[model samples]
Target: MRSLTVVGPSRVEWREAPSPELQEDTDVLVRPIASATCDLDRRLVLGDSPFKPPYALGHEAVGEVVATGDAPCGLRPGDRVVIPWHISCGTCAECGRSMPGACRSVHRLASYGNTAGGHWGGLFDELVRVPWGARNLVALPPDVDPVVAAFCSDSLVDAYRTVSPPLAAQPGATVLVVGGTASLGLLTVLSAVALAATEVFYVDRNPRSVQTAARLGATAMLITSYSEPVSGVFDLTVDASADTEGLRRALKSTRPGGTCVSRSVYFTEPALPYLDLYASGVTLVTGPPHATPHMPEVLRLLSSGALDPRPVLAGPYSYDEAPEVLRDPPPGKPAFAHPRAGAA
Candidate 1:
């Protein structure tokens, strides 16, 4: 089998790798039918990330079950499923509490597609192993396109976490999304609009993203600076911007008692405006996306046509093009179409 390996900054190549097999009674083997690059994956390929090279290069994918263990799971051979980026035993205490991303049974930060996690092969591989199959795989609806499954694994789910819960808490709330992080901010805007927010405001230096946000029904603004807040306060503000200044702007733009959620990862410790937070009573939420618990709902939205994320998909490139496309990826998310889909 061949897997995409990140050999260095702005470099990737297909390397011969071991084909995965079902190692446990509960384990399953899958062939990626479609895989997409997350914002972090883009950084990794561009050599802009903190993680070093020599690791498998993908995490988000929708795959076909090529083989299943003897254990009775909801899935079987030929089933198309969404593979979560994180690895966890579905029956763990943390998972039982709806925090599968932090499952105590696996190594801390255990996941596919990154060196920080254990050596689970990347989704870009020709074959991959999925442990705890019953708990980790979500069956995709027959009506949904396989390409959409690419984002369902992580990017879309991460954006869902940023907006869905907050909107549920504050119905028809106004939203402000700062989108320097990449596709997340645009997806966040889309999610907010789908959930019926009174108004959605998007700020990004990239005119392309701003234009996309407008198409998604957001009042998009192209800003020259991340240092200053967007025009008005909102019921919910998201710091999808990976920059510190953008995070600060999102925090300061949150209305009194409003909530601000940041979906971007910060490598360096950033200072916050304590006095402003104290006076405004702002609630700030930040952490890795707990996507497992929300995967079902995300699927439900797609199935019911309540959410349409297709606008953000950049390409449906063939598997052979994964290397070059990932190296110089276009603006939106890029998904690769694997050769085998329903192989026995």
Candidate 2:
């Protein structure tokens, strides 16, 4: 088996690796049909992030079950499924509390791609072993395109988290998404719109991004200057921009007593407007999303035709192109597919 491994800044190579095997009765083997890169992966490839190199490079995918253990998982070989990034036991205390990302039964950060969690291997590998398969895999709807659902593992779920709960709590709420993290911001915009935000306002300097957001029904603004926050407040605000200015703007724009969730991963701590947040009584939430719990809603939205993430995706590149394409990824999110999985 050959897995795409990030060797250093701006470099990736196909490394021959041992194929994974089922280790538990609840385990399953899957062949990745479609895998998408994360913003962190782009940063690592561009030499712009803090994580060191020589690790497996992907965590998002839609896979086909190659084999299932004897545990009666209601799944079978050839069934396509959405593989969540986190490795959780589903029955753990943390998972019971809806925090599967911190499942106590696995290594502290147990997940695929990053070995810091455990050497669970990458979704880009030719084959993967899914532990606690029944709890971790979500069967993909037959009518949905696998490539369109590839990001369901992480990115889509993360974006969905930013807006879904808040919008549900405050129906027809106004949303402000300061986007610089590429597809995440746009995906967030799409979710807000699909979930019925009365107004979705997106801020980004990229013309393509702004244009895309506008096409998705957001009041998109291309602001090269972020020294000032967008005028007016919103019921909810999101800092999808990986920049400090963007975070500050999003925080300041939150309506009094409203919530602002920062989806950006700041490797280096950035100075924040503490007084502004305090004075306005705004609640700021940050951290990686608990992807598994929120996945079903995301899929339901997709299945019901209430959401379509394909607008923000680019490329159904062949698996053979991963090493080269990942080195310098495409403009929008890139989806790599197996030649035989019949991905679109």
Q: Taking the tens digit of each residue's C-alpha lDDT, what string does model 2 give over 1-344?
A: 98888888788888989998888899999999899987877886776765577777789999989998888898888888999988999998999988888899998878888765767888998899998999889988877778878889998999988888898898999999998877999999999998889999998988999999999999999898677658899999999888988889998899999999999977788898999988999999987678878888888888888889888888889988888888767778988877765743
Poorly placed runs, candidate 2 (over 4 Å): none
List the pairs of residues colliding in candidate 1: none
**Each model's TM-score, in the order given?**
0.96, 0.96
Backbone-clash count (model 2): 0
Q: Give the Cα-based TM-score of candidate 2 against the true structure.
A: 0.96
Q: What is the alpha-carbon lDDT of model 1 when measured against the actual structure?
A: 0.87
Q: Which stretches of candidate 1 lie over 4 Å from their true place?
A: 339-344
